[model samples]
Target chain A: MLFKCLPPGAEIPGRFPGPVHARGKWFTIDIHCHVRSDKAAAMVEGNAAVSHWFLETAANEQSRRINRENGARTRLQGSSPEKRIEDMDRMGIEIQAISPAPRQTYYGADPDLGREASRAINDFIAEICGRYPDRFVGLGTVPFQAPELAVAELERLHKSLGFRGIEIMTHVAGEDLSAERFRKIFARCEELGLVVFMHPDGFTEAASPITILPM
Target chain B: MLFKCLPPGAPIPGRFPGPVHARGKWLTVDIHCHVLTPQAAEMVAGNAAATRHPREVYANERTREVNRQQAERNRIQSTSVEKRLEDMDRMGIDIQAISPSPNQTYYSADPELGIATARIVNDNLAEIVGRHPDRFTALGTVPFQAPDLAIAELDRLHKSLGFRGIEIATNVAGEDLSAERFRKIFARVEELGMLIFMHPTGFPEARRFADHYLVNVIGNPLDSTVAVHHLIFGGVLHAHPNLKLVIAHGGGYLPAYSGRIDHAASARPDCCEQIHRMPTEYLKQLYFDTIVFTHHQLEYLVDQYGADHVLMGTDYPADMGEVDPIGFVEGAAGLDDAERRAILGRNAARLLNIEIPAAAG
Candidate 1:
């Protein structure tokens, strides 16, 4: 039920060699994965602007009303590391490159709180990777609404947290990633050769056009 | 330049040990392809639904305006035979399976006009195939708005016109293809062993995609994703395992991001009870086109779904369509010469029941 670190390891899918090199034979790395930390969630608890995407329908209406729809979003969002390790073994995944879930990106929160949440999540990810260094790698989160603070946090994750990359929202609120406001942070990351993992908050469902052919 | 009957010896792409058993190399087939028939466009003239999505929808005018502009581009292609041939040869496409443009589908038309337009559109398609049987194949359109009429048109396509399969929009009106009213028609298609090419018009509701061609860049694929997920959860694939449906636009987005769908089927029995298996399992029974637009994306598809499930498609003439389809496949780092040949033409040849002359072994 509780996990102090990543489960163990997983096998690579197919015979394709993974991006990361291995000592024996071949291994796989899961780059599009996320980490959920209670400590990080706490930092943004009252920050409605930094919340998980709202559920399409009422959460209470699901087969059972257990999920708030607004809650962690999925069971895996809060799955224990030990349990993930079990999943890794079953999937044959060798290692996971974990980043904070888009929900915890916290770019919309107050800059101060956003930085705190980013630190909390980045630290938790480092902890997991530290526990099972071979089975996990970290990509820290950055709150991009305020680029100066974001650059500061980005530096911390790379230098102190030992993360090789940083995950960011494709857009800050409705602002484009190319907006002049965010250019400096991206430039810094590029200068440092840091991998910038751009994540989307997902798209909304549209009504499929109904065409009753012309009368 | 003259017409009909596959030259049988027509050369296409990569030389392999191909039906070396025969006399040809591999016949490159573009399964997720389209045709712009002037006659069909004429049939829908003055019909705004032909150019627009028809649903009194969209939260903003941007999507409508963008579509209006796109519809204008659709009319300017000249639709010339030489242009098509030149592009096909340039793209390494040996054979393109021609199907109706979404604007020409007219699925919402009254049965009378639906059947009438269907006939003229299909006749034009047949005429093209008749002239260049070696270069193109026909995938006819039916009036899916009315199932009985659709079935009749289908029979005519297979029995009389001798088409390989039929093309249907992802949805009829707002009804998913899995709706009860459409089952009999699908069952009949299964019995006939014809391919069903499911192409998207645009996302029905594309308000959010108003600005950047997101309506198409994302909406088109997302619409197909919804259509497909509904089909799986709705049990169409379970009931008709023999169905040959080639979902165009690279099988939309479902082939690549289907893990969440499989998980949903497991997480929600109430919604997924109609099917007895995992959603991904049903995906294996379907086919995809190779218009996805990137090397790694295409590689992930062939690697995830296997080369047997992929057929080359160029959505020919559409601005968003793949330009160098064969070159795109060749660029994918993982595929072997065999996989490249399969994605190029081998798989499509098998689906259409056409024979490729063997390569020099």
Candidate 2:
């Protein structure tokens, strides 16, 4: 069979498994998956609109199922290292390159708030990847509206946290991706060879339907 | 052997000639050309020492020199009606839909100054187009930063001055075109059935693009791209489905990269929160020009958006504009005779509702 779901460490029995070596098996990687941090969740918890919307949506249902299936272990929530590894094993994925969920970037917030939120998200992602060294890599988030701060965070993510790249929302507070304000960010990314993953946020309007979704 | 310079006013001339003919001939209209009105020139000259926006200031001697040369070329080519007509004849273009040069839009100015400048520019353009009604039609400028004033001027231009359309910049003082404040102006444009020609001026945040002419080469197209994305994702197009919006510079980079937007919208619910359809579907509703500078580029534009949506555009009177627009269209590989005719003039004629001469072939 081309696809199979095997338990982790099953291949080597008594020893920790190396790469899966079942006959005719191939290693697979999913690069676009997103992860959420508890700190990021707590920050948005006070926003009643987002919290209520999330509780009523399919996303919340999925989150509940993951938590329930993992026996309510705090570290086995959807974005937790333990949960990610368990899911990866079940799905036959060899590695997963995780990026901050777009909502966690918080680029629309005030500059200082945006910077602090981005740093926290980046730190959490780095820690998650650190725990599962061979099975995961992380991409950081930056507060692009503040280019100077964004560049600083970008460098710290690369040099200190060992992040491979950054994820950016399609627009920053209604400004286009091509706005001259972002040139420094682009230049720094080019210099650092950081892969830019452009993710879309809710459309430019505050009345966007997705605005109801939890951040 | 494939290219020929058609004689002016000649019927069935070897080259494509201007749309109007003494005898019957195929019409060729340049829809994307610009003219700098005398009023605009006077204002700029009068305001030379005024406080300048940081983006407008030249950063280095080399940058100043390059801009000076370009500005000189623009002054000579853009200001004189006779020179423009002669160039049109030389290029085998018959009619031109002239708009005030993008620089003259001047949305950066204070509301009163901007409104005054727009009126002067619009009147000057009206006068120029009036002199050669057979050879020219004009699009008006408005004080976009002041929405109320812009709507009033739009009504005046459409009713009194007989303009069929208005030209606008991509943004007004760093505000996106999709900002809620601009919705009324857009609704008016739609209600009045006025065509929109969106051109970009100096890009916001152009400090890095100060050197290498990157501002024009890269910045201009990026501005158009940004404008279109906002209009699409912000639900402007969704609300105004019949809006006859035309983007210059071959619809910028949007037509080429729209698939990425479509993919993003499909994969994420947030991206489609406003519009139900994909971004490319909205792009197809818009029109593009042939100012992309090369046959392959024009061909790609025609392919990405159908030939009927593509029109002949020469930045006109600017150094960067196509010098041989007819030749460029004639040389596009794989275009059939009908496709060539549509792109050259028929499409623009239909869009502007210009009556073709009965004798035209």
Candidate 3:
């Protein structure tokens, strides 16, 4: 039984746990997926910190235009929940662990605002998972740049919100993952036996790969 | 000593070690690099047997095509050896071990042709390295689809061609690395004490990620994930305990995620009977390359696998690759001098068994 991506509006052939119908189906885990709503994207876009980082890190003329455009739109974009569920249904994916899109990972300096935004996103993700318990699970976000706040949020998400894990980018700004500052979060995660989904927000210094829309 | 790419015809820096000036300086040994030639690309593209497999199994069509194009017109390729050497000189790279691009691993039905094609590419690589004895070395290629032919080529590379190591894809099509058919090859490699550079080709039926760019970006890691998982869970590593294998892309997300594997294994003892040891123990035995482009990742890789088990790599000539591999490791915070040295070059030396002349460093 192979795992395959089914076309949109395609009929699901059997039980979710039944043999995957996709070609060359490896183990049936969808480790990464994203969700976005227009309202949520707008709120993030309006944030001053996001706007500031967008300006500072936008290296080229084209990247600057993209950063400004995204900032103005104030909308989250990636895979819609409908599209995500459809894709999962097509691929015959048994479990889908969804997280905030990578843009949320790069929440620039304002730690207070970062925490506020993260709380909102976590609450939203939890709701989404609750709405579709069997089909979906969420990996929460915390204010990683601010270690103490990040740790506190991590505790709340795991102990209270019931998220299975937290999604963390490989680095914050230029800080390495193994830095002593990050050890606080790592220690907590190690003790809890929770998974940390480590991903990268494109090449840190280079703006070319991250900002520009792919051709 | 920051590493930077140079364009063609860039001035050969005065700082570079030339016949006139040789001095003690930062020593850079690039253990991972490749030479993609037009002949190699044609060999891969022309092979009907290789293309007979489903395209859905490919990681990224664009990445594959770009690589193929680069190989087809080596004359117009972005990463020219002249430019690479200039940049190496600027960055103080004293040595580089060139190997076949894993993209060229496709060889169809004819094992004999696969062997011949591998020899042709390897000989070309050997020639390039031979011309720059002071600054380069070659790792010979093998047609993994043909294990017997592969071993024979390995002997030839080690003996006649004087290559330092051999390179093979992590899995041949859907076959396990620990299967009986590959034991003879592994035994020969172990007997020769040669380092086997294990790189991931596209995942089996990897093309599904095509729409989202997941195959190359995500599927490649998953492929490595499955390969290493099998190596440990399938008891391949345990059977041939001494088989030295190096994985690319920071061991493809294995180090950070290994704890879950052991937890699952212990939790489901009945299901995981095939795996005997903790995943962490097996992880410690494997070597990972530093193509994972962040400092923290470098630290995590070193922390989880130990400094001596990490080596430097840059998937050169590919857009989806690191430009300054050594700098990335060096810049990693919390890494002391000893760990830094080990990951940058020393570990690769021990693994490849390259004897550094006392006068060089």
Q: Give the per-residue lDDT digits (tens) of candidate 2, residues B111-135.
A: 8888888899889888888999989
Q: Which model is ahead, 2 or 3, in terms of DockQ?
A: 2
Which model is ahead, 1 or 3, in terms of lDDT?
1
Give the per-residue Cα lDDT of candidate 2 at B60. Answer: 53
Q: Which stretches of candidate 3 lie over 4 Å from their true place?
A: A1-215, B1-24, B51-81, B269-271, B359-361
Model 1 agreement with the true structure over B113-196: per-residue lDDT tens digits: 889999998998898888898888889999888999999999999999889888889878667787788888999999998888
Show model 2 residue runs off by greater than 4 Å. A1-215, B1-26, B44-55, B58-60, B263-273, B294-297
Per-residue lDDT of B1-361 in model 3, one digit per residue for the tens? Answer: 2214656666433222222212233345667676765576676675666654333444356655754654554433333667767756655566777777775565444797788778888888788777777777888788778888998999998898888788777677666565667767878887888887877765655433444446667666767876787677666676667878888788887776887776645433221444556656776788888888778888888777788888887766455566666566667887987887777677777877777667644
The local distance difference test score of model 2 is 0.75
Best by lDDT: 2
Residue A187's C-alpha lDDT in candidate 1? 96
What is the DockQ score of candidate 3, to 2 decimals?
0.02
Q: Please estimate how well model 1 matches the true structure, expressed as its whole-model Cα lDDT.
A: 0.73
lDDT per residue (tens digit) for residues A1-215 in model 3: 11123345554333232353773465566888765533445666866656444224635554456456644543323435555566566677756788886667545757887788788778888877887887778888888889999999999999888998988876676566666888999899888887889876654433322221111
Candidate 2: true interface contacts recovered? 0.00
DockQ (C-alpha based) per candidate is 0.10, 0.04, 0.02
